[model samples]
Target: MPTEPATYPGYRFPAAVIHHAIWLYHLFSLSLRDIELILAERGVVVSHESIRRWCLRFGTEFAAKLRKRRPRPGDTWHMDEVYLKINGELFYLWRAVDQHGVVLYILVQERRNATAAKRFFKRLLVGLKYKPRKIITDGLRSYGVAQREVLPGVRPRTSRYLNNRAENSHKPTRRRERQMQRFKSPEHAQWFLSAHAMIYGHFRPRRHLMTAGQYRRSRDQALRIWRQETCARVVE
Candidate 1:
């Protein structure tokens, strides 16, 4: 196992509680206040502000560690974009996922035009180590333009119903958005959602496709990986 960073030193609480709070915030539809209440009932009283600070500081760190441990992206990609409202204005959240629903990248932008599509493509290519063999997307003309420019050789398929994998991945974000009563700002949305995606992908196995025994095994493995990556000494 790769050594995680040194334990966080500034916190008064143990690493386990701190990590648990962060995990609950991202892994479920719990708001900061909701988490604070849950912890309060459990006899661990922490302010919601402290939970927010922990998420802001340590969420990215945990995401980076999990991303480092994830398997390579699958060869086929399904891409989609959804609109998110921030401060009464609409913005697009560009998301790409593989065939198995592993998220490739998510970007929040002011437009869903060709320029935005091209930027998302570039970001995915630069961040991921491998190029996709084929791409599936909705009948979005911008995807064609960006694909031709950034990945000229890959096969691109445009279909209305075939890209549901990418579209379905947005449900968690929607639920969380509702739980938190919408995002405060674009940067805030991006930071929280990106880290949320990483943590979600780690714990979420394809449960419908697995038998009970397999599901249990997969879940145990996911938890083990999370502990190893986050350097958490306690598992709840």
Candidate 2:
């Protein structure tokens, strides 16, 4: 069995274009139409439909590569869930990020309960390859129960201000949701968010903690990692 090749016949946009489109989609809170217009201004006329497809395909691929190359997050993990409405239906997006605000993993589920919490925890453990030392969540009783069963020795911290790190991390995702006018389905939402999380994790530097020199170094390191990953894929 042979894999079918992806065809983009009429327009010969470089990999850079696909990369640029994905970056713009995440970096700025831009819609597909908005991205098309931005690129049009730069003399690259691409349809919104094309841009959307590029985001789904290249965005996911790029994110996967970046995830593979980047360092694993620390043992202190913060978890949170946000509600999203897609086509009048409600769903939850469970996000777990480490101490430095690097996204560890994400899952979209219909409900936020003990079972959902356990499922998320299982996914997190598998993806991260280590049980976190401490887990923080916003007064979610399910987290307390799940942690006891799955990650028994891990300390569970449930407090108002304590979970602010996870709460603050949702801002970029919320901004992106507003630009797209909400997702069409759970599958679409999951795909887009998974890609976005990877892209976000790549570019975002720990600005709050680093000095000016240290910040620049971190920024350079991220870009270096991204370029290396992109080049490796090209070679393969």
Candidate 3:
């Protein structure tokens, strides 16, 4: 689907600067102040507070645009959940990825029970627009219950050994979580991670599996898409 142009009316900085700040914040482990300094070094004098506002305003918008450009996810889906602490309270971060490590969706919930698993499953089915042929997950009993209720026909494979794809996907989130000193709240974690998954997933081609030439070409293509998506004409 073609993306309609976006406008940055009433903003002091240009859209490119806003996009740059957001991209930097999500694509790397940089604090708001860190991003502010980096932009200043490049002669773009914006405050860290302004950077924070830009991310809150436009990060998900940008992610939606990029997701629209993605191909359909693979038929084999992998799901996993990890505990995240927000304000010293525990929340579950449920994530799903395809066999190729492309993120499907993320949900921040208070429980990792059958209810939560079912909710995540339904969201993924609706979001992805199709049922996956098979779901891979760890030995979470909730998955078995949720699979029956939500996606009965789809095969569910249970075993820790088979779910490395989804588990490995958490590594980047873990890194970013530590870098940011943990999320302030569940809503905060959801927005930041939802954006992170899309942006990071776009550029993170499996270089280990590709030839050097293939990796370069894939990277160049990703860069082109990022440029086009961000630098396109903004309506007034």
Clashing pairs in 2: none
Put down candidate 2 lDDT per residue, 44-124, tens digits, no spaces: 889999998878767788888888887868888899999999889899999998888889888999999999999988887
> What would the TM-scores of all predictions be?
0.94, 0.88, 0.93
Tell me model 3's lDDT, rounded to 2 decimals. Answer: 0.89
- Judge candidate 1 against the unseen true structure and give its global Cα lDDT, from 0 to 1: 0.90
State the lDDT of candidate 3 residue by residue for 1-236, as single tens digits: 66535647778677778888888888888899999999899998988989999899888988988998988889999999999999989999999999999998999999998988888888877755678899999998999999999889999899898899999999999999999999988999999999999998898899999999999999999888887877745564
Error of 2 at 186 (Å): 1.3
**In model 1, what lDDT does residue 124 have?**
80
Report the C-alpha displacement of residue 236, candidate 3, in angstroms. 9.8
Clashes of each: 0, 0, 0
Pitting candidate 2 against candidate 3, the one with the higher TM-score is: 3
Better of 1 and 2 by TM-score: 1
Which lDDT tens digits does candidate 1 get at residues 75-171? 9999999999999999999999999999878999999999999999998877665788999999989999999999999999999899999999999
Looking at model 3, the pairs that clash are: none
